[model samples]
Target: MSEVNEQMMPPKVVLPKLEKNLYEARAIKSFLLTAMVWGLVILASIPLFSVIYMLIVEGGARLDWEAITALPPAGFETGGGFGNAIVGTLVMVGIASAISIPVGVLAAVYLSILEPQSKLATTSRFLAKVLTGFPSILAGVFVYAILVITTKTYSAWAGGVALAVLMLPTVTLAAEEAMRQVPQRMRDAAFGMGCTRTQVIFKVILPTGMPGILTGVILAVAGAAGESAPLLFTALFSNYYMAELAEPTASLSILIYNFSGMPFENQIELAWAASLALVVMVLFFNILARIVGRSKF
Candidate 1:
């Protein structure tokens, strides 16, 4: 009876040992690859960190509330600020955003949802892609000829138009991509519930893609804010406050460009401070985009 009971017991199972040589070889390769990737990342970050450090050291030294709210100093003046430039920059950027966002978003909607495969959409998409690589100076020149020359003066309106052209392609492409990412089931569900195409777009697609659209708009605004060439041709420069959109305007970028080339030390210091301020504005827009992207509808 004891022998029978012993025979009925389950047999012991032994697991096979893993090959240490193979495992160690894979582990070494993985470690080496990871080390190489980290090395490359650090290498790429050097220039960026260096630039930020330089800006902080040079630009930060001159940044102050007075600098933020004061007008640009004259060539021989010792104590002045760039308040007008800041205001002008904001005005022109706001104008550019107002002009570009509506037109670009509409174009994006047409291309992505309404008639994606149409010949007109294809041509437009191609043109927009081409414009993405278009020279910023050329945009300035085009607006210069069309608006500045026709109106017989450089003005914030011209600068805003030039910026709008540069911003349009980016906004259109980004918004289209964002809209395309909307799930097909969402569209189907909307339709199944008796929603019209336009209704679906406004209610479902636009809300879902708002974050991406905002991101593109903010990026375009940031890019427009830093552009000196276009503003040079279109807005020229103003020492005093801007009175109207039709008047020449001051901007942070143009201030930096003009100030940096001056023989005066004070203006050069103002340029550094303006450069720092422009960098901060761009950083702020990027942060806003991040926050918008993470928010739920």
Candidate 2:
């Protein structure tokens, strides 16, 4: 009777043993940890959003079409555009780039292509490093000596010259790095093709390094745009017509400074608007740099 009962019951099912996947478990755990870290970082952007919100709230009311299109403030007017400051900033920075870019590129080329054991290059490189660390206020003082006190006037030329000094190290370093990135084989090939050292550098190396050079210029321009100390001493302040190059020339940054310190709420609002505009201008250049760097020569 017992045998018949066992035979009637279903046979016990057998299942395959599960493999222990320690590696996959560990991988999943690591992925979770990384995702958590990034998630926390994303949340930390809340303050940045808040600041943007405050800026928009305070500045938006003052950013009407007329505020954007009107000329510089006239004798304590509540609302005025920064037209002259904008133009002056552009002209001064343009001149600064004109002076600095060529000299910087030349210096970079010399460092990359000239004597392998040059004491001059070493000295110049050390000086550039020192200059990079120099405080902006010190640069302003230097310009003050050269362009303001000695010249006895605050010319736009003086401001441009000050900006040139401020920009030189950045351009030189960027250009040198770009030059270093040029493949040695290309240089060798150029030499093999009966090209002179100058020809190879100017034609092949420079073009390839154009990306870095342009990046340097953009950074320099951005830096010059935000500077206040150098401009303060060299350019001083002006609320009226755009002064001569040898006289005080107000800038957007200078205006922001002057306006923000006022007791008027409207002036403070203008400061915020101006600050936003400056940030946008810098961002514009950064975008331009990316576009230029990616373009085919």
Candidate 3:
């Protein structure tokens, strides 16, 4: 029994000691790599931080209630605001969103779910990828040629159309990718339960993918909101408040572009403030996208 117990006992454990020099070398290499990564991150962040700091210093000085709620001043005028531009931006963006979201989401559904292997779907996906890199100025020119010329005036409607064109590709591609991320098991289960394709898409896939879809939509909206060139060609910058979408409209980007070149100091200050406001708006949309992306179905 004693012999058996001895045989069953675990052998004496041993841990080999690592060489001090080799351990030190590995530790140093890891530290150096970590430092390099951090250095690169900080170096890349410098420009972004500097721009934000500059905006706060310059724009914060001129940002106030009047800036938020008053009209922009003339070149010689000293105390006015860009309230009309704010309203115009919201209206145009709203129009763009209204036009883009449903169409884009539905197209994404067709591409990712209904007819994914179809030649038309392949062509659409290719064109969408191409449009992702398509120049913003070209989009502006296209809208100018089509909507602006047909309307006989630069209007918010034209600007919204231009932005919609720019936004569509983003929304479509992102939503399609999001829908594809839905697990195949879910689709199979839905089919096993005798659910129709449309029913499965609407009831199972869309609900599961809502967070990602919202993220894409918000990101597209953020990109569209900051566009200046399209609005320049389409809306043409109104001085007074816009009473309708069919007329010229003010926007923060246009305001900044127009005011930054002026000889007047106040207008320049207003431009700075508008730039700050525009940045905040874009940042807010980005943050919203992040929050939505993290949400549960």
Candidate 4:
């Protein structure tokens, strides 16, 4: 049996002394600041919660199954469900997303994977950055000047095009960021295995970056949804039921804008209810995007 000498054993390493109590207090203060920020976020949410609560209290009595299910009323003074507004919002948003997504993703892919150092990419990136900073009203004005007056009509198509412009920068920047987040090693390994650029991007990068892209799309949708100024000039508003895409269609935001100024309590209540609905819908979509983005396919 080998005799182990206690003194011969390696001296047990001692950890450096922790910083003084004052340093610990400073650390605690830093943690408290973080907690305070979270508390502020919670507090900020209160106004939205309060608005929803108030809408529920006032509009709940008027909200019957029939009222909720029925279409918009034939007359302006008469009450009706916001089904038409709902449909208009969906159609416009769908068209806009369709137009924006492909272009944005393509632009992002080029910037991230193809010609990152090229002057053309640089110019395109600069343009996208400029467009992102462009006012929504300016977008509305641009569309109005180009599509509405030139085409000589207010159309859902014009509205969609305008919204697409607004969404493009958001999607492009977000997708580029998302693609950038993918590890270079993963990309290198795929390339090392003789994978084509297209194959690596479509098969590897996009999948990994999907979560962030989805979040960006969600944000874009929410931004577009609440945009009254842009729609004011592009989508316009109609009180009557109209089936034509070329005709001005009423949106929830537009309707709220038109109705909110009325002296009548009923119309005002309707506006509140509509606003609440929009908020809830946007919140639902944001949550869905987060969940879907996080989920494995």
Top candidate, metric lDDT: 3
Which structure is stronger by lDDT: 2 or 3? 3
Candidate 4, residues 134-164: lDDT per residue as tens digits? Answer: 8999898999999999888888888888889
Candidate 1 lDDT over residue span 169-208, tens digit each: 9999999998998999999999999999999999999999
The sequence of per-residue lDDT tens digits that candidate 3 reaches over residues 73-132 is: 987998999999999999999999999999999999999999999999999999999999
| lDDT ranking of the models | 3, 1, 4, 2
Clashes of 1: 3
lDDT of 4: 0.81
What TM-score against the true fold does each predicted structure earn? 0.92, 0.85, 0.95, 0.85
lDDT of 1 at 187: 97
- Candidate 1 yields a Cα-based lDDT of 0.93
Between prediction 1 and prediction 2, the one with superior TM-score is 1
Model 1 clashing residue pairs (backbone): 70-81, 70-83, 71-81
Query: Which 10 consecutive positions of candidate 3 have the poorest summed lDDT?
Result: 18-27
Model 3 misplacement above 4 A: 1-3, 17-28
